[model samples]
Target chain A: MEVVNRYVATRHHVEGAPTEADFEVREETLRWAPDSGEVLVRNLYVSIDPYQLNRMKRSSASHLAVDGVLPGQRITSYAAGEVVASACAEYAAGDVVAGVLGWEEYTLFKPSPGVLMSKVDAGGGFPLSHHMSVLGTSGMTAYAGLFEVCKPVKKGEKVFVSAASGSVGNLVGQFAKLAGCYVVGCAGTTAKVDLLTDKLGFDAAFNYKEEPDLKSALARHFPDGIDICFENVGGEMLEAALANMSVHGRVALSGAIAEYTGEGRRAVPDLLEMIYKRITVRGFFAWDFLPRFAEFGVVVGGWVRDGKVKVVEDVSHGLDSVPAAFAALFRGQNVGKKLVKLA
Target chain B: MEVVNRYVATRHHVEGAPTEADFEVREETLRWAPDSGEVLVRNLYVSIDPYQLNRMKRSSASHLAVDGVLPGQRITSYAAGEVVASACAEYAAGDVVAGVLGWEEYTLFKPSPGVLMSKVDAGGGFPLSHHMSVLGTSGMTAYAGLFEVCKPVKKGEKVFVSAASGSVGNLVGQFAKLAGCYVVGCAGTTAKVDLLTDKLGFDAAFNYKEEPDLKSALARHFPDGIDICFENVGGEMLEAALANMSVHGRVALSGAIAEYTGEGRRAVPDLLEMIYKRITVRGFFAWDFLPRFAEFGVVVGGWVRDGKVKVVEDVSHGLDSVPAAFAALFRGQNVGKKLVKLA
Candidate 1:
């Protein structure tokens, strides 16, 4: 089988704040043979994530963990799709799957033990879009960071989440609340703040842009001190959070979107505070907990069914909108998990 | 009974690099009565540590964990002494004790269950100075930080210790070596570097003062990347270590001597590096593991007796030299554990 695949590619390495002009639609032919041991996928919905910006950079520390995205190359991404043709026994025509697909209309994937792709049920009652949003990398990141990295959380403990309206942050706030914690989140806009408190069930939400001194802002919010901080923004926010953390506080260093674009100041947390409070700051990835995916799925799936977790997603249309959707993340324009649905 | 007690006191709150002029030997009257339930002791050796500088500061985060040193007041410290008179049932005249004494000629103590004081055998076959050096807080800190915080360390794992000639750092390097690790350490001078490589059994040693770029220096020594870092010096040294760490690296944030005096630049580690490496940075105090102190003592004591570890002690004479001895720590003048023996 052969098909023309149109994918979004960076025209050049993005070193600063990315714009839609940095990306272009490039087309290539993808082929699959009967004995090639590969599956041909027609991508339905591709995930637009903030981490991709780091991969698109000219050089970055992110390259140490994941492969860098080269200019004019088909960027590998997490997406949901249907099997158009199969050269392997595990996947067949019309079977729905999710994992490491790409930003193209079609992806030729080789079946291997280490491959992230997995067959998801199409008749599972939940929309296929849920597989790309609430049950995807965003949910996995939240569950792994909260349950695995920051464990033994007691009920009524204060939990603070930065970038609370964003993909991973929103889910983290929801999960913390479900775990019987007092959740507080900070976002850039008034609408996102309202979305967090009114819709997402965050106990409190505030606009970070209005606060000049982040340290004082955190102190005002957490008078008793934050026991667990789901850190995503990083930079001065991380510094402020550390300053107001309680003794034996735990910080899951999930992401640093503030420092990713090279504009924000790097955080200089008080090392004395860390030692005096005996805090533990651990950095991890969602994939680090991939071995327990089914276990996490069983738990999170119940939340979605019981209406305990409200799925928040902002979707754009077509491969050409990938640049705008991605650039919107850095601008804080996306309300939740940003996804691009193919036309 | 009443006697005049001469003790070292800070002249004023010190906010910068301290000098001998910052301290004075103040005399006060001490009274011990049979009805008062107190014990009188003649002070011998008192520990002089770098952490005292923070206690002398007008205000600091250190005050959160330990009490601050008020100007012109008796500064409570770690010391060893011989009992002169006893009104308490737990002690008797002529008994040797080591624990929370002070830098004074004589101390009047009321023995309480929560008090840190402990009776030591005068004929224990080790000098009293050893109690203040290797068997004191320094040994406990090294043991807890290396074994407890950075745990499950495999044999042949590379370990890097900063401030390698200092009290805790020296012991950490030695303990890591005994744990079957390939250890490398950095110190301020060539003499200290030689002590690490020659006297201490470090696989390699370097004068960090001579290296223009700490990141490159670490990379050159640990081409395969550092698995464990026993960080003592913070600021730029910490930033560099994070940059060159291996996947799943562990950093025990024991102390930050560099930032104590507020002279050094604050460390701003690249968050991307920390996240991509899946590192764990934990801050701890020896007192946090006080419950296991005796357990650590048994293991470390065996190593000491078998000559698997070396005890380094640098002592000054009398309470008059307390100021110089404490100030010399920031100047990197002390060889190992700095102490002051009262006359």
Candidate 2:
């Protein structure tokens, strides 16, 4: 059968800031074929993230591992899709699966060693988009950073999150609150600040743009000093967080979207504070916690079902909008999970 | 018996920089009385350190846990002394002990719980002053920061040290070399740079003063980037170190003399780099590694005896010069371990 696959493509090198010129939508023809170990999937939803921007950059370390896209190469992302055909014993036609699928209407998948693809429970109350979002990398990132890395969140322990209204930060704040810790966060705008404090149940939130001094702003909100910091924005926000961290505090480094674009490095605060205060700053990737994925899903899925955890999604329709949705993450346009719908 | 003892006292708070005005010598009358577990000792050598300056500050977190001097309380420090009188079973007359003793000719030690004192090995070949220098807190700080915290220093890894000619930095450089790692270090002066490269056997050494661009200097010296950094001088040095750190690098936070007494905090490079690079930054105190002191002593003592590890001493004679000797650390004076001899 002939398949008309619409996919987002990286058209050219991104200069100062990414614009529409950097990405394009193109039509592709695909033959519906499933080899012995392959499956054909009709795309459902795709995850859009700030990390994808780093992937687009020429000098990024992430790009070093994977070949940089030439003009008209299909943009790749974590996507959830329904299997239309399968010769693989693990899956059959009409089976729902989630893995790294490109921004396309139809994708051909061949089982390679170590490639992750799992069947989704369609009976679950959550939408299929949730598979690529709250139950996906974003949710896992928040879980690993907050619960695993920044462990033993005691009551009244103060926690701070930068990019607090974004996909990962939103869940991190809620998780901290659920653990009975006092959570404070920083976002770019007052609307995000309000959303963090009011909607996300954060103890305090600030618009970093409005705050003249970030260190003073943190001191004002957390008089006792922060016990844990979930760092997202790297440069100035990370410095402020480190400055305001209390004795024996922990900083869980998840992302630094600010510095991913090869900008000249910013100044770091006196790390001697880390020595005097006995801080433990550790960097972790969510994929490292793959062994705990099933365990994490059980806990977070239950929280969502019980309304103890809220899943926020900023979803755009059509595979053509994948580039815009991914770019929106860097611009802070998305309040929570940024996703693109293919069907 | 009447005993007249000379003790160093803080005359007045030093403004801007420390000087002889920061201290004064005074004679105090002592009663020849010994309680059940108390001992009267004559101090022979005292440790003058960069951390002492932090204690001199009015309200620093590094200040003494007990009430700080009222400008007249005798300056306190860790000292190696010979016991003249004792009522404790563990210590007696003529016994050599190392503990927190005042910077004075004589001190009364009331042996409380957890107060440690052991007879010095006269056959150890090294001078008793070695206990106050390499075999004491300074040496232990290096051992702990290198082996304990920045562990698994595999052969062929690159190690970077700031303040490479200082007490702790000097030892760390030697230890990293012995571990078969390519060690590079930065010092303040050309003389220290010579000491690091020529005497201490660092693979690469640079005078940070001459190189205004620390990042470029580091990139030039360590093209592969540093696997471990024994951070002593914090601020811009730390920023440079972070910018040049390899993936999975470990930073052992030891001291930050650069910003110990300052109006503003030091600028740190992007900490998010830690996240992307998956670096591990840990702050540690030497006291925490006291349990492994004997094990460390055996290895280091053997290295020293074989002449594989060289110990450099910047000894300043006379108790009266204690203040000046300590102030030298902040100014990056005295290659190797800085000590004050008072007999």
Candidate 3:
């Protein structure tokens, strides 16, 4: 059988802040048999994240994002899709699943054990987009980072979430609130900051762009000291947070969007501060914590039902908007989990 | 009642690498009796270390060495002393003790609850100087950094200890070796490197100063990547170690001697390396792990008896040499534990 698929591909290697002009839509004719445990999937939704920018760059020691998109290659993303054809016992044609699939209309792949792919259970009242956003990789990231990595006991302790209204940061703030912490967040836009406190139950929120001195901004919010920091934008932001961290503070590093386009020479002036404060600055990936995804769903799923947790989606219209939607993330145009819808 | 005691005092605020000129021997006349819960102790041995340098400098956020020595005040250090007089029943005259006291012949102090001061049994058949070296603050620091912080399972995993011949660094290397790890160490001098491999049972040793490219030197030693880093010298050594760190690597941050003498703007070029590898860079103080001192003494004390562990003292004579002894630590003049002897 012959099938035509349209996908977004990088025009060339990306530099600095990515723009819509850097990507072009390409067509591919996929022809394949369902080998042993193989299946053909129709793409439904795809998630855009900062780490993808690492893969689009030239090779270096800091090229951590393993699944890099090559020139003229379909961009790889965390996608939700429907299995159209399968030779696997695990999935049927109509079963909805989430995995690291292509940014295309169709994906031809095999599901081995322990692959990034997972079937999404639709028993929850929320929409499939919610599953792709809050209950998916992003949600799991916030949960694992807060519970497993930061391990904040709360007790009215300060919790600082950078990129406050973004995909993982929003969930982290809500969770911290539930855990009895004095939650605070810093985002790029005033609208995003307002959403953090006004809608997401954050105790305090500030626009980072409004305050050039982040260290002082953090200190004003966290007079006592930050017990935990869910860091998204690294470099100077991280340095400022480190200065305001209390003794034995834990920093769960999820992303470093600031240094992705640069040479990644992170100047942590007070890096030695960790020695005196007994700070734990640990970096983690959500995929590494996928083993507890089911556990996270049961816990966070209840929070969502009780109206304790909030979800936001900055979604694009069609496959054509994928490039612009992804580029919008770098420019801080998207307020939450940036996703593109496809058929 | 007019007995005069000579003590080392900071002449003025110290800047950069400490020198003998920064301190002066000042004489104090004793007059007051031991008040309620107070005692007069004759210090026998004063432990000189790098952390004291922080106290000699001006204050800032990074001045985390809380017990900073004021310009005119006698320097504070972990001391082995004899209780000459006591109003508190907990300590008797002639009682041999180890505690935070002045770098002087006598210290009039009260033992508060949870005080750093404690009585030394000296029942292990080792010299009292050992109580100031391997059995004192330095020993406790090494033990805590290696065990509680690093948590190495060994199984032939690689352990890298920087400043391998210094106070805590020697003990860390020896402990990692005992724990069945392939231990490697780097130091400034070839003699220190020789002492690490030949005397301390390190699997390999390199003079970091001799090797301009530390990353390459570390790569050669840790071909499989470092499992645990008993970090002492930070900056370039830390950067090199981070580059050579394996996935799930643990860095037990003990000190950053390089930053102590210079501006602490530690530029970790590729700090994002932690995210991809899931590395844990934690800073810890030995005081946090003081409760485990007896446990360390039992385990390491046994190692001492069995001749598995060794001690090296770079002792300075008289109270006047204390400044020089402390300055020697910055100069890398001392081979092992730097100490000042006063009788």
Candidate 4:
């Protein structure tokens, strides 16, 4: 069987903030054979993430962790799709699956033990888009980074989340609240900030753009000092958080969207302050906690079903919108988990 | 009892690199009474450390961790002394003790549960100067920072030490070697570098001053990447180490002597690299491990006795040498532990 696949590819290496001009829709032909032991997937919902910007660059430290995206190459992302055809016994036609797919109409995979792809449980009563958002890498990252890396050691611990309205940050704020923490978050826009405090159960929220000095802003919000900082937007925000951290504070580096765009300066925290405070800063990814993915799914899935955790998603239509959807993430235009849905 | 106490004190707030001119020797008459419940001690050996520079500054983050040093006031330091008179039952005349004594000829303290002072076991079979060096805070800081903070998880893990010939750095190199780690260290001078490899059992040592680019130097030395970085000299050293760290690397911020004296730029580590490599950077002081002081004393004391770890001490004579001895630390003029043996 052969199919025409339309995918979004970078027009050139994205060195700075991403725009629609930096990406293009590319065409490809994918062939599958019955005895090939491969699975063919019809992509449904593909994730638009900030971290992808790093991979699009010509050279980046991020390339060491995730495969770099070459110019005009198919972009791989955390996506949900339907297995339209399969030669592998583990997957059959009409089965839904989610893991690493592409920002294209279709994806072909040869299933193996090392494959990130996993069959989405059909019996799970939730929207397919949730698998691309809350039940996906965003949820996994938020869970692992908050619970495992920066665990709230005490009840009512002050938890500060940067880029709080972003995919993982929103979930982190909600999770921190559930763990009995005094959670405060910061976003770029007033609307996003309102969404955090009013809709997302954040104790308080602020527009980072309005603050002249991030350090003073954090000091004002967290008078007692931040106990656990879930760092998503790095650079100045990280520097500010480090300055206002409590003794033995834990900072979980989830993402650094600010630095990825090259628009913000890299954080240069006072090393002496870190020593005086005994701060522990750790960098981690959702894959680091892959063994606990299923465990997280059950707990987070239940929260979504019971309305204990609200899932906020902003999705664009068709593969052609992939460029705009991804570009919007860098601008902080997306209110929540940004996604690109197939036509 | 009446005694004239002469001590070294800062003439003014030291905001930059310290010089002998920044300090002065002042005399004061102290009258001790039995009803005062104060234990009077005649200072013997006093510790001159790099962190004290921060305390002498008008304002610094170090003030949060340690008591700030006011101009013309006696600066408290880690010292060993002989009790002259005691109104507290725990101490008596001729009893040797060590802890938070002053950089003066005499010190008076009211013994309480919160007092840092501890009686020195004369039968411990070490010189009194050793109490201010290996068996004191320097040894404790090295033990806690290496074995506790940046613990070598596996045998033969690559360990990198900066400011390798300093009091704590020297001990960390020796300890890392004993822990079965492949250790490399960087120092400012060729002599200090030679001491690391030739005398300290380090696998490799280099003069950081000779290297034009620290990142390239570290890459050449740690081709396999550093697993544990015992950072004493921060700034460029920290940034270089982060760039060349292995997956899940641990960095224990024991000291940042480079930045403390305003001689080096603040390290601005790539946040993306930290996340990609899953690095853990922690800042800590020896006081954080005060609970295990006795435990560390037993273990480290055994190593020093068995010749498994070498004790290095650099002592200056008289209270008048305090300023010069303290200033020498910033210039890297002293080897091993810098101390002032009072006359």
Best by DockQ: 4
Clashes found in each candidate (C-alpha, N, C closer than 3 A): 0, 5, 0, 0
Q: How accurate is candidate 2 locally (lDDT)?
A: 0.80
What TM-score does chain B alone reach in each candidate, compared with the true chain B? 0.97, 0.94, 0.96, 0.99
Q: Model 2, A300: alpha-carbon shift in Å?
A: 3.1
> Which one is best on lDDT?
4
Which lDDT tens digits does candidate 2 get at residues A137-230? 8999999998888984578889999998998999999988888899989999889998887888988899988988888999898888889999
Model 1 in CAPRI terms: which quality? Answer: high
Q: Where does model 4 exceed 4 Å of error?
A: none
TM-score of chain A of each: 0.99, 0.94, 0.95, 0.99
lDDT of 3 by residue, A1-343 (tens): 5579898899998867788888999998977576656788899998988778778876643454475568789877789999888888888989998887878898888777646898888777778888878888889999999999999774887899999888889989999999988899999988999999899999999998999688999999998789999999888888889989998999998887778767444647465578888899888888787779889889888888888888888888789998888777777788889888897
Candidate 3 vs candidate 4, lDDT winner? 4
Model 1 TM-score, all chains together:
0.98
Two-chain DockQ for model 3:
0.64
lDDT of 3 by residue, B1-343 (tens): 3358788899988878888898999988865465656788889888888888877877743466476668978877788889888889899989998888878988877779756888888678888888888878888888898889889875798999999999999998898888888999888898898888888899999987789788999999888899999999888788889989988899988889988888534647465688888888889888898779889878877888889999988888889898888888887888889888889
> Worst ten-residue run, lDDT, model 4 chain B?
B108-117
In angstroms, the error of model 2 at A179 is: 4.4
